[model samples]
Target: MAKITYIEHDGTRHEVEAENGLTVMEAAIRNMVPGIDADCGGACACATCHVYVDEAWLEKTGERASMEESMLDFASDVQDNSRLSCQIKVSDALDGLVVRLPEQQG
Candidate 1:
């Protein structure tokens, strides 16, 4: 399993153990991490699960898919590091992955 950290805009931190094969969005929702609405579940159809991948873990999380990029257009405060958590699949390589939530989801 990968250990993922979800930090709220206010700085609240939630660390969760995500099984390999689960999406980071699923891990956040399962752990009840506030700020990740995951409105469309893991379908990559919405921006409610928007997050800023920690620069240190960006490569490990991989690039956003075309669909994810389209969905991100609906999110606020987009950044170079912005990502749709639902698009990031967990894996041993993603252990200790950290993502920061925006002030509010789209």
Candidate 2:
């Protein structure tokens, strides 16, 4: 399992053990991380699970897919590091990944 950290807009943090093959959105939902709404579940149909990947781990998470990139437009605060958590699959490579949530979901 990968150990991922989710930080809310107000600075609250939640650490969770995310199993490989599950999406980051699923990990957050399972761990009750406060900011990840995941309105479309893990189907990548919504941006409610939007997160800003920490710069240090950006390369490790890889670039967002075109579909994910398009979906990000519906998020509240778009940034170069912004990504849809549901599109990020959990893996050993992402064990120490850290992502920050925006102030609100769109």
Model 2, span 45-106: residue lDDT tens? 88999999999999988899999988998988799999999988899999999999999987
* Clash count (model 1, backbone only): 0
TM-scores of the candidates are 0.97, 0.96
The regions of model 2 sitting more than 4 angstroms off are none
Model 1 — which ten-residue stretch has the worst lDDT?
60-69
Alpha-carbon shift of residue 85 in model 1 (angstroms): 0.3
Q: What are the per-residue Cα lDDT tens digits for candidate 1 across 11-87?
A: 99999999999999999999999999988887888899999999999888888788888998999999999999988
lDDT of 2: 0.91
Off by over 4 Å in 1: none
Quote the lDDT for 40 in model 1.
Answer: 86
